[model samples]
Target: MAMKSSPVVLKTWYVSIACIMLLSALLLFPVRISLASPAVLVVDDDGFASPTDCDGSDPAYSSIQAAIAAAFPGDEIVVCPGVYSEQVTIGRDGLRVRSFDGSAVDGTPDTVIQPGELTPAAVLITANGVVFQGFYIKDATTGTGHAHVHRGVFVQGDNNVILNNKVEGRGTCRFADVGILVRGGGVGNGVAENNLIENNEVTNTCNGIATVSIATNNAAAYTTIKGNTVKNNLGIGIAADRTPSALVGFNEVTENEIGLKYNSDSEKGLPATGTKFRCNDVYGNEIYDAQNIATDNSIMDAEFNWWGSNTGPDPSKISGSVDYVPWLTAPKEEGCPQKGRMTGGGVLRGEVLFINKTKVSATVNFGFEVHCNNEKEPNNLQINWRVGGQTFIFHLTAMNYAACFETAADQGMPPAPFDTHVGSGEGRLKIGPSPWTPATIQWMFVDDGEPGVGKDIFHAVIIADSTSYVISGKISGGNMQAHPDDP
Candidate 1:
């Protein structure tokens, strides 16, 4: 009877255990992972042990195409310094390929892809959000024609940044392509910013940088052609046709047969509209050449426009081997080329870097100062500064470059009241508030339309209760430049 009772109890215990296990499994079903998104792959010409190695791998792939073939959407394939003798095509969205190191030579013009060996381009992209930075693209002997027959970097995506890379030196084209051609591949929103096409020394090319008609209709809106140094090309150095409100600024186009040209409409005789050419130096262009007539071209708000045939001070003197300062003259130099020069102080030619700021308090104020060599007056050269965001444009002006400015949030307004102050400079001063929290600030020199300029030095002074705040900035819309921080 005792043995029978024990058996019955064991059976009951097993049934309870099974019921508990079933309940736990029902509550803890496995989930499926999402792998449909993009993946970042690696390619080292020298070879990598795995995809992770290619992320920053040494002895990289001998060919960039090899690495590109293995990439997916939202994938970043970083290539090491090597010679790739094949053409590469990137047709996926959110794909980015760059050099392992940040040095220009490391990725800029160093990772050479000879397109002659293949029938297509050295690097051809067709998806949105694809970024190609810091790579050298070239045409090989087997390459069709030097004008690339196509392009060094052909992008057809939106939100793409082709920055700090070199696309140069073409051979021939039965028709003509570009060194860097950006177009809308179906519905991509693309942009080309801060790229260096300098010393590319192109020849027999249609255009150094070409923005075509396809980009106009696609989602790739607002292309910015800035800070590019284009030289020695047969066709237009930079061309934007059928593009929507293209913004071309701060580009140096020199020694080209045709510096800058545009025709927004597809109809040959039609004219383009809504294009901007601001603060660019279009000097030493040979527009007199038969094949290079800058016809139906319109220019606005541009600073320096010196033609090669002009008998004036060489614009190259501003930043060249020769130190000759050309006399500023009105009108043209017999060749009908508009004569111009860098307005305002020579010290304005530098770059600006914004340090990130951390907001400590909801309502806070900030203060900052600028340093200068000379201190004189109520208005010698009008100094203009602008701040704020997309909705509001808060502007401030001063007569001297050595004054400080402050912004205090909680001190004014209501829930987020901010007080702003601008004054003379010297020593350690701050912008914003005391016991300050962090906020973003951007400042630059605005031209008040005057001449007889002297060199000016504008240094940024950050004052806060905490030194751990980060700040970021860039100089916009001025003939002057901001210097980069020392490495």
Candidate 2:
């Protein structure tokens, strides 16, 4: 015995069961939604057709601060080429404020930021992981009779990069006229670390590049200052006060009141250990090259630097307890040294070698000779070389062979090398390579006395393909004289 239902009721019952099963399956397996990438916001001085829309299209915001307010994390703010006269504060994380043009040196499309009267800095950064680049940030204070700490770019957060910008005229305030200031304080999880200040020309301020620790308990460490031309400042070129473990190198610190100053306030503890200074050209300052006013007994390592002389820095030039032993004899080039060799098929083939003997004393020897295949034609060639900060120029047109020695007597070597050459006097020809072949000639100098043990310091290089020419060396150190011609 089976109960038989109407066809319509059976169909309706089947439809209801199917609907319930589908709902159950959906509940068991849920669908997932993914997030999209971050967006870009544009800022232009020209009026935006739509102010609310931040799509970075034709209609953009007039002010940079407005764009920053509407931007999300990891968003880029591309500023058009114009003079922005306002105080810009970036309080968001992972935001980039860059010019539309690549760099300020790229002409025409320049992004300049000039602060108003009440503005403390042209650009102030309070967020982490931010990048501020390619802008000419200047004139911190616009009006007179107002004295507030102003800066070109004031950074207070960690892991930030300030690159390839020209910052100048931050000199209104008493103690705050700094081109680029990395204010040291606690941020987020820890103190500010790994901040890179590179490739910027910072000048005409109280201090060119300064890292000050406002918090006595915590100081900024592991800050790297490299490849920046900091010159002609009223105060110290590069000042590191209360900042520890800072790596400073390859910076042209010249023509400033004080080239480099490292001071630890008595109230603040001594600068942390492992502060290294190397490969910097510290010269032509009005006062001392480097001064260390740290009261503590901690010794800072400022080894391997060119103090504008081949004989190294005088004891009176350095203050406090700085270890500048075994200093370099010539200017250090920016970035890593490149090993170069003569290329291209030509008539002349020659190699130049610089040998340094450091075991006995701080003396370097340079040996360079070129051979030409000419029996009937005059064997005429010129050789120019630099060793121990002295340039030696020799004309080999008349002489069959000649040798130049700077002599150990000039460098106070106990056993002086033979000094018998014609052009051994002080007045010698020192000219850089011509503009045509500016890749072959390099001003090579060594740090250590061991031959081929140190890096080569080449200021300029010129490459030529001609057979008959004159060679001139720009002397940077030592007294060199040309040897008698050999037959």
Candidate 3:
């Protein structure tokens, strides 16, 4: 190759070598890149705009349905605080429909949607992965002029979340007026599953929260209904007519004709099996706490629930064969704490005995003796107290559980964190503590983490007089004899 090279040939050769080097470098070291976020559209009812004006700028879209129609998947639609009198149908997936004021608990949600008389629902969701949050859906109309059946919010989709919304149904009509309805039917169309309905206030309707499976084959399963206040309805507070594999927990179902109703006829091949009802305060219903008309051989697991009485739920209240054994004696709300409070004054005595103690953890149990004065027996006496982990407390003669106070790890609370139970008996025993007598309560506690010896504390307060008491004790792998003068 001792020949002389031309200048043009050398220039082309140098460029070719540079291109190969660049390609090798790129293959060896990849560069980091950032993706653009999804678009966010706005809808203001007071604005003068059209469906085409959905760029999330000034003069935003006027109608919610229009913005949803124009938006692509994974877009967000922020609604301004005003009344939108139209039916909104969401058919796009991964869309977030929120109010301008954010969450409903942040303030009074002024983003109200009152559907027109001709509309079937105030808000109808038919798409998957849609989030409808922080809005007031109300005033669904009735009569021959209006739609025969009007719903505040109707969901027929899967993996959707309906949170922090107030749904008040039309008070005029009794039948087919549902506050929030999740229907599952239609062949080839997907059944509603893995959906969440949480932190909502549903009232003044034929049915507060209803999940009906009309299809003969498919069902609405794995739906979670939690942390909702469903009350003052003409019909059932929460109805799971043919919805199986549902988790209904931590709800206040009261002041309705029926607190909770589950009906499934096995002859039709629709059985409401694998339904778990836990930690709910079901009371004040004129008819029953829960009516289970499921004819299937499968039994409904309804345990750890407060049925407004210490003697447990009356067998006459539940219609079908429900396993309500080991029911919660105290109301779920008052006894389950979400925060750790500082020890306070009380006349109660606490004793902790360790069943097993290891370097990693300890298995111990607690005992407390509460002394009451016979002369000062208050007419409506109630006791609220906490021990061990913060989430589960002991409450006597209370209706509901307390709201979650802190994060689970912050308070060292268990997932299902309540253990206290009221005594099962008759007369005053079914209500509250007996006057002038010592009430001794005991519960086992499994302490987690590196534990040598754990100290458990007790805090009790008479709700009527605001009187508080506190006590503490240490637990190790040793038995401590009870005080001779105790009780």
Tell me, by lDDT, which candidate is best: 3
- Return whichever of 1 and 3 wins on TM-score: 3
TM-score of each: 0.50, 0.59, 0.60
Looking at model 3, which ten-residue stretch has the lowest summed lDDT? 421-430
The TM-score leader among the candidates is: 3
Put down candidate 2 lDDT per residue, 1-487, tens digits, no spaces: 9988899998999999999998765444321122343666677777332223433334566788887887777877777778898888888989888877646644543778886742456787778899887888877554456566657887777779888888777553365578887765555543566677877888788788877665653456667777688888888888777676566776789888878877665445545544567667888887777888776766766766778887888667677888876566556641122111110111111223222211111122233322111122232333455545554443333321111122222322222222212110011123344222211232222221212122212112223342112222223343222212222
Instruction: Report the lDDT tens digits of candidate 1 across residue range 1-487.
Output: 4544588788999999999997766444311134564654555565642444544423334556665665567767777667767778777667778766533433245666665642345677776677777776665454434332567676666556677666664544454657777665453333332222322333445577766654334423345676576777766777765554455544667766667665444344323333444334566666621121223443322222333333444443222121112211222222111111111233222223222343321111112222221132222222222223211111223322121111111221121110121122112222334232332222223222222123222323232233322222222222232111111
Worst 10 residues of 2 by lDDT: 340-349
Task: Report lDDT per candidate.
Answer: 0.44, 0.57, 0.60
lDDT of 3 by residue, 326-400 (tens): 566667655333322111122222342221221112122333222111112121222233334322223333212
Task: Count clashes in each candidate, considering only residues at least 3 apart in sequence or on different chains.
Answer: 65, 22, 14
Give me the runs in candidate 1 sitting further than 4 Å from their true place.
1-40, 49-63, 103-108, 117-120, 142-148, 185-206, 214-221, 266-271, 288-487
Which regions in candidate 2 have their CA more than 4 angstroms from the true location?
A: 1-35, 48-57, 105-109, 117-120, 140-143, 170-173, 265-270, 314-316, 334-487
The per-residue C-alpha lDDT of model 2 at residue 80 equals 77
- Model 3 deviation from the true structure expressed as Cα RMSD, one decimal place: 17.1
Weakest 10 consecutive residues of candidate 1 by summed lDDT: 412-421
